[model samples]
Target: MPTLTRRIRRTAATAVAVAVAAGSALTLTGTAPAHAHTGPRAATSSTVTSAQLTAGLYQSAYSERNRVLWATSAVGRPPVTRSSLLKVDPGTLQVQAAYTPPVTDAATGAVEAVYGIAVDDEHNTVWTTNTRNDTVAVYSQRDGRHLATLPGVAHAREIVVDERRNLAWASSFGDGTVVAFDTRTYKEKKRVTVAGTQPAGLALNERTGTVYAADLGGDRIVEVSPYAKEPRLIPTGDGPISVALSADGRTAYTADQAAGALSVVDLRKGAVTRTVPTGAGALSVAADRRSGNVLVANRAAGHVTVVDPRKGAVVETLATGANPNHVTIVRGTAFVMDKSAVGPERQDQAHRIRVGR
Candidate 1:
């Protein structure tokens, strides 16, 4: 598999041209139940759109009722590298803009390691987790302009911000804890220790001020009450690497990366309600908060499985590229980071797995 940085670098230039021709929202699977979503549409369908291939990582932004994509590509090898962000229209799966993060260190001139990118719709800001630097970099979502660099975060891996409260929570891989920051001041607020071991993925039910953290090392999912003095531990599935919360905040989904299974945890009961088998090597997982379908990106299988959260059943499967690492579902389409499938000569080739009504 190609490194995330390598993948992003390959697709950088083409993303811009693709963005100019972009149009409507890219549809994924149809919304399921009142809380679930149907699987991705038929494989042989007209929903196909030409994609702007890139080398690094892509994150979906649900803004203005249209699903836009923001991708960042890294240059150079491991320890340090330069990265630029790009805007994508899910409807056309085309790149709109290629953006640069704040150049904090004139000597470095790039982000140390951008692991996760998230958007603050209310504040119109986009934040990326600078994993190598232990900081979060903020940017203007509208124009892809650099805003500020927040330093001193402890091993931040995945982050989600609540614009209403002007706060962001990050799951720290280094400290096995959750760190809270005030978005406005870019300063630390609370460092809450979760019951699980190594925290990996993060999700926030902004409606209830509840944050869900997946502790990969502890093999469980932990829930933290943002408004409470001390957050509580609600046992989840084993080897849960990523978590997704429902729009209603009544249910949560976790991708058991190690076990190749999906776990459903009910917030009201604080206990797991179901576990469903998925493809091998389920590395990244996502959900449609509005519809409630759990999308699992199986790295080894090169396919994504859509799970009906209500029954814990596998509803649909779509093939992807090799070593599919990240899966982000916006209003209609699901953007996957196919780090390995694209050939050395054509690293910008990634499939746009569309799911529609």
Candidate 2:
């Protein structure tokens, strides 16, 4: 196994390489902001509000059952010492409760910091990806209590829950595999491998029990069906980091970080039908069910671009904070987590945008 330091360095190098390949000059340490394309093309009627959260905020999920939001945070590089799971009030964006992760090494004070989060409302639990420690953990959504930690998830990037099937699927970016676990037992149930692809973000189709993974390294989407013997691959644009499914499940949208575009894939045809230019460092995407508008988080541009699938154009641009890492839409509201620039004084923030229909 590679040392923690080596793993972190490798991941950073890969990210830089991907950015360059996608024709972007952005680097891990570079703080230069990428300009967003705005004008009459952008929407002028969207309401956006923000709140300062803790540092190192990476991703967030909304729990319809609990009526709250869950987020994960981890500060510093390898040997990360500061990390917490936060429960926030969706309306006010206030931190209702915070739970610290258990220390892994007593002498060194190392912790299993989490980076990605997903909520399983059916079971009233939350799942988090401990990317630094290569593991996944479950927690109680009611009180922010630790439930269980399952190890051996190499570089876990994202997780999604299938409440109907009682399963949770996680993507292993380092090993190009998606592993499934029984939600009730928290045991590894199946592992589906997508050779030569680094799976980053995951989206599940509840109606079909099919999981779609964004292939960051291969520029494609890996489709894993419950009944299929082999997974299917649908080609996408350069450096597709995150993905979202349309309301009808007929189209899949990808945030191509390297290309600074959103690739719309026709699920039935298994091909990219359109590539719409979004902005630089498009890290995450979410589809609003009410208006059917797709929201893309542009990390380098420090804004969120709202696109109308029917028109194939950007309708509005909402300026988020620096480094918008992830966006999740819940009940017609979009929650964006921004990991404000790299520094001790720079606190992360969460933005709530009401994407009007």
Candidate 3:
């Protein structure tokens, strides 16, 4: 079986163009539950638009200071030699610029691949998880110039930076650990490893100095503490590929891929509060800070589910481009890593959905 990265990358090759639609607001009259999003179609208040991006699209990060989005694209196998770093305009859903991260090993000059990305607006920096070489590279957000590289992270899959904490965290699947570093000094601070943990997706709440890790291999979400103590493990469903934390750091959301549900986890208690049946192949989830909505990507279903705070139920389902793998929200707009499955005509794209304030 192909690795998940390769499988997703291969799927991008056959993407077809899709019509982006405005998200409608949904209201569930049933019981008001935190995980009350049972069926699809909510009161939609968002308008969706998609733009065909460079192929091999994977993960995305947003720069609030620049009002733009940064996406990572990878191609080639094993030691991936080619990858595209794209800068997109959120309003128009257009690619403003594209650059390739330096994937060659600096000391040995070997080929490598890039996976996850995060934007540090406070430092004017862009970070990419150089997977093949076990390193994280920092680039200039303005010009996309590779500034520095910090190597030695094992199979880094997802990355998150907490400017308030002045620390950046990367999830290492190969080693079952989460690596934390000082963003200002570019120094390795500590590596938090939990037994049986294969961390995949990472989310951070700088305000509370809390980090959430989706341990895909462990079937749990581990709360990694860089300051002290062992990681807190929150048992989840079968396979959790991605995660999103509320701004207040009180609640967490996961795209439980294997379980085909959007799980609402209470961070304070480290337990799953509710599980909404999203669909098979739900890959990533993003929280809307402004409206307090959880946006879930249904890769197999070809739609984005909006879990509104209203009665804690799913209020709307917005149509997106095929295979919406990852999503992030900036202001009132959602930047979705939407793509098409393997086919003759592929419309692999980065889609932007506009939501009401």
Candidate 4:
């Protein structure tokens, strides 16, 4: 896929364009209450609840140490002037505080807009991707204070922190590279380039210090190891935008956006074992370690699909909101962040779902 096309497909905030391009056939409108669409064994509506948080919500991360949720949002298109880093209460689904990024150009009202977010529990900081600025920013998890802005990243997308290694790894979608930074010093440590691939979402195997990146353009997963000279590639379903590993780290799950499916890959074999159709524009995915289930955010389909990896089937489809961008699992609970639908009154929302087996 071309870089431009991949960019459009990857951004759920631009819902209309993505829906049309992906052939979602969604009738996006104002005052359209988000509803749950369940399968035969789907979780009931009682298991899911939503709260209108803000507009342009992209991704969220749960801080285990602080027991809080950190979210990122960037308003409008390019030259994005307004953006915020929100500290949310995980249990109440309430915004505790919001912090604005530092202004880049006063004349244009451009600030360091953040889109993707990750919590660094070991360092007590939050890392976010400044996509427009081609950099990554760090903030204090306790008080939401701007700590540092590291530049030179090309279209930074998703980030993951290795608490055991005391390092943060961010995927650069524009240049097909994943850069590692030392959490303690806030300095660049290494840059691993994946040739001819646009790396989007990232997952880290803390046990081995291996990083797995979803190649949005290449339709594969790039495995980067600290000791290896080159990254290895594992083929997956079409347009694998987001990736997550099972609790045991023996398998990988990818939300295949273009194919609207979940590609399950066995890490030891380095091959996709099954492709489970999720929903339209399957975007983000997270594995519930406790339940051993995989939750996928179907952006165009306007819901989150809960898949039983053992059965290789979608057991439940819970409607979150329009353009569910990402899913983050903490202690068996799933937090879904969705962008605004294609309407004036449609606003972004955060959903807390008790994903029970």
Q: What is the C-alpha RMSD of each candidate to the true structure, in Å?
A: 8.6, 11.5, 10.4, 10.1
Across 251-313, the per-residue lDDT of candidate 1 in tens digits comes to 888888878888888878988999988888877788865456777887777667777778777
In model 1, the Cα lDDT at residue 188 comes to 83
Model 3 lDDT on a 0 to 1 scale: 0.74
User: How would you encode candidate 2's per-residue C-alpha lDDT over 274-342 as one tens digit per residue?
Assistant: 888988999999998778889999999888898887778887788777889999997568889998854
* Candidate 4: C-alpha RMSD after superposition: 10.1
Instruction: Give me the displacement of residue 110 in model 3, in angstroms.
Output: 7.2
Backbone clash pairs for candidate 2 read 43-315, 43-316
lDDT values for all models: 0.67, 0.83, 0.74, 0.84
> What 10-residue stretch in candidate 3 is worst by lDDT?
24-33
Which regions of candidate 2 are displaced past 4 Å?
A: 1-44, 341-345
Q: Estimate each model's TM-score.
A: 0.80, 0.88, 0.83, 0.87
Give per-residue lDDT, candidate 4, residue 223: 94
| Global Cα lDDT for candidate 2 | 0.83
Clashes of 1: 21
How does residue 25 of candidate 3 score in lDDT? 21
Query: Residue 10 of model 3: what lDDT?
Result: 55
